[model samples]
Target: MRKGFLLAVALVAFLFPSGAGAAEKVWSNSVPDSVWSDGANWVPAGVPASVDHVVIGRSKTIVGITNAAFAGGLLLSPDVSLDIRAGHNLTLGSGDAAVNIELEGNAEIRTVGASALAFDAVNRLNLNVPSSARLKLGKMSAPAAVHQSGGIVQLTGTVTAAAGGTDWHVNGGLLYVKKNDAFSGNMTVKVAAGKEVQFEKGADAGASFDFSAGSSITSLDVADATSAVPALKLKALTGDVILKLINVPATLAPGDVLRVIDCDSPIPAAAQVRLDPASAAKYEIQLSGDRRSVMIGTRAVASADVVVFTPPTDTLASREYEPGVPFAASFDVTSSAGQALTVTTIPGSSLPVWLGYVVTPKGGASSDVTVTLSGTPDATVSGDIPLGFRASTATASADMTYTIVKKGSGGAPGPNPNPRPGQPGPLPRPNPGDPLLPDPNRKSRSGGGGCDAGLAGIVALLALLPLRSRRRK
Candidate 1:
């Protein structure tokens, strides 16, 4: 019958043999004391168990594996290298599928017993754990992570979340214990550049530290601001926030009080405030105790820095409005130079023909310009009614001399009870407040030394990361 069907097809191709082209153990030449299961140091003649698929070279790279090494996939491609020495340990997943690992060089990953060191690697992985290694994170999906830069990473067992995102990049190292240590989801910490990662707070988990500005947001949770909660809460997001009142200590005898910024403490006897050496140097900022806290100095009998436009009254009191009742004064169209500043009003033909000049562009985020000297006295008469105002920009300019007085005999309406303390003029040219008179247009700011001192270390690295408050800024 056709020679017995060609001797039964050559005895079924000489007794079965079809694993679909499996073996690919590459680790040729340059034998630097090899022993990764030894077979003349693995090329294709044996020693690579559990369905092998490995490749180690950029010159064979110190291969040694006393035991525990099973692979179905692994490739340290370009300029390669690997070292799973120190008592051997390396386990990659396969059961639930997806197991790929295709790294590029300098890997010194070590391990031990009781089952650890589990990283699936299906796609992108950057786990550079140095300081000799202790990595244990598996149960894969894809986006794998663990960039420790100087070893020891044991983020709990069973390992959850690692499908779309799984981050923990300290960049330098030392993410050891110190406290609770349990972490669940919310993981996104990338504090690099001279790295630092201090952890604590487990049980249920909570942490927040995002040093904005192109932020990858470092996560922290060291806890202890009287921990019932806070261990770390480092998240500094300040583009600008100023209430500066430095070294303002120089007031002796007008009730000698130089409080920096007191938004509103006790005091409410109709709102008391006693500090006005003629509104010092024409005034620049003053809510006058009624609103409390805005006493910046250099005007105790001065003539220039003028702009503390008043009416924060309770004393020196004499505010009697009858003809249309609402004449006001309180100015601070502010500027540490963040924006809006350009005001001009000049009406002094002996002003008040029963006048009207209501430039009300009020304050907040530094916007204070309140001048509403209502009109109605069409005839009730008055005297010295001068009006002038200016508030420039290009660089800066400020001038004001608004005076209005008209009384049909009553008792209140005061200010200017014989106050003449003048002496301050030259300050329009190149603006020199002077430290040797420097101001050749001087404008260099943000220099405490580079990156504005690294953004003041983001509040000293959010008070040196230990975390609390979660939403932080």
Candidate 2:
């Protein structure tokens, strides 16, 4: 029986010697290059079968692979692109074999036996994963851009945006959403401290940027995104990084914050964090004491520092000053930090040009600045102009209004407009009419009402004369 089995094996080998072992196929090198699957385009004179090991060679353009599966391994080239058509599954890195492949095109490319895939070389991989396709990236250096022009990025293992200046753009599809489950690219990125990462919008319109719970990123840039709720709730655990929150809403869902925590960042301690209110107001950015996040609002809206965004009010409250007639307005400023505060006028603000103003005591609360329109103001200036000044240590600013009154329109020095509520009025001129609006006192025989009394007596005497004349006649 042994002799008969050996003879059968020998006969089978003699019948199909090449079929026993698989062949290696290389792309065609001749002019007028042919397609990848063409039988005449391979070095072995025939296209590779499912069992043959394949290596994609350099081409003027990308080559297409339309096969179900490969039993052997594949060696992909960095210079060339290999596209696996839809409905076809292409495998690489089998039996400890590996290749350097940068995924492009709109088809699916994944490993069959390999569990992990590491990408490298400052990848500009513009890969699209349709619902029928998924991606598996191993733990490695982050790519320049993980653009989801379309499709699912199946996280087989932890991925990291671990380098400097990395960008992850999302146009459509879910990035592994299953509640508070925090992972890289889902809600956070496992990046080195101070590494810059930008979250931006792409072709998919009406799509808002969403950052998950426990998000960790360094040097974030979300200036190009607009979110429905708090777009990012990342902990500054990544470091105290300077970030721009443009188009970010003031509050998310009534109380949620855009930035949840600011811890571990490399940002240094500052006496005050100055806010550019023009940009902040456009994006609705505000910060509360409870919420250390950048764009979050507090339960008490007034508790937050939104004075920068508030418009200027009447600084000279109820007080009117005429031009060339020196008058002063006092502003009592309070600081959040009891630290000594320094006050200065903001440049480009409505600073007094025609009117000379001086801030007194330059420090501490209950401080008053005297603004007097001592010079001749422009003839056209007659309304309230806003004067902006900021406190250094307190990080607070005031928008006070100054009225540039016409020459002498203000009534002659009446009672102070801002007098105390119960303060007494000016002394009255003794008269039966209104005590106010009384005639000025004159030095004559009688103080006042003497004219009325004398006039009444003369009128009575004149009436008596008319009666006496009539008796004599």
Candidate 3:
């Protein structure tokens, strides 16, 4: 009995199978109107529901959705098109199942009014807008990734991505986000060499792209064109963003300004918008005074001709310096056309401990500036000491080396020829008439009357004087 029951069950299962009732509903357009809710428009005689995969194979058939509808999947044949009429919506995927929508050979999906193609967060949407096809929508909530190889996708309304993240690839196409539209997603764009990704604004007043919801853009490609340069505006950058330049035209010239990004809010100090090295070499990148825009000017604008007025030398001793005397040397740097100039001490080229310096007009858009090196060297400092400095303008830079030399403690102290009132005077001169006192100015004789001889002579003279007095008496 058990074996008979098993055989009957297997026969029934084989006949029924799984998903055998699902059908691919092709558009036949048998009805008078293009209403998608009409049962006569789709072959197999009924409107497509959750169990049906909708295929628009007719080259120019326009299907209109009057109300909310569901489909297992949607596919547009080459040169075919699908339109979700205004005030209506069509949803792909039933329940938790995933839906795949492929557009091949210049097909398009255009939506109007409040109409939209909806997908559940649990549903994966595989949408391909490739090669001359277009996808224009007012609003779209992308639950899964959207891949575009070489077509255009214009969003005039908000497109929000699920928390799981969405990767948008614009391989060789244009993705234009219109003014004031908010596109929030963890989107990584990989644009081809000649492709473009633009975020535009109507009046440059409000934010063009809002990533404030923690959405991030890993990489973006911008074109090097005189017109239609890629510009983006953000409230704030909460993640790393990189800007790359593509399609560098051969007609690029000096002094040309390429406006790249515009933002309403100040970019965080820690957030850096980096450019590729090759592009950086060809252009001068700078932030606006408000720190809200990134501007790129041709290298020519920054390449001012810098002229150094101070002659180049290896020695800092421009003038003779006494050991304890103050020393000063000035170097003047100016740019062509009076462009701004900057003078600074080169890194690792600091002045000696005994020396100090100051740069006049510290830094600004000044045509000329001076760098003065001054110091007082004591007797202890001597010999040559290395010193270096760099002078630069927006486009030009020059480096110079000057050394300090300390002459020995200015020769020993010389006698003060003219003594001050309180200081000691030279020795007193001897009187010419006094035979007893020898003159210091003249050299002494070999046997001149010394101290003892002089005293004895005085005594003898006194004794003789007494003898003479007695004889006279």
Top of the candidates by TM-score: 3
Supply candidate 1's per-residue lDDT for 324: 55
Error of 1 at 385 (Å): 18
Give lDDT: candidate 1, residue 371: 57
Worst 10 residues of 1 by lDDT: 235-244
The window of 10 residues in a row where model 2 has the poorest summed lDDT is 201-210
TM-score between model 1 and native: 0.27
- lDDT string, candidate 1, 350-415, tens digits: 445566656566655764565565656644554445566666544545555644554432222233
Candidate order (TM-score): 3, 2, 1
**Alpha-carbon lDDT of model 3:** 0.59
Output the worst ten-in-a-row residue range by lDDT, candidate 3. 409-418
- Against the true structure, whose lDDT is highest? 3
- Model 3 regions lying over 4 Å from their true place: 1-21, 30-33, 144-150, 163-174, 184-196, 201-230, 234-284, 288-293, 296-473
State the lDDT at 349 in candidate 2. Answer: 72
Q: Model 3, 1-473: lDDT tens per residue?
A: 64753454344335323244666676777332387888877766898887567776665666777877777777676666577888777777666655666666777777787777777643456556675677676667776555555566777666666677655555546676663545665543434444555554331212232222222333333453233443554544433333454433434476667666666576655445656677667766667787777766766544537556464342323633556788887666666666666777779988777678876763566667777877787887765666777777666676765545444312212122213369764455566546677554343334665563477678878888878888988
Model 1: residues with Cα > 4 Å off, grouped in runs? 1-44, 47-75, 78-115, 118-136, 139-307, 310-357, 360-372, 377-406, 413-473
Clashes per model (N, Cα, C within 3 A): 22, 7, 3
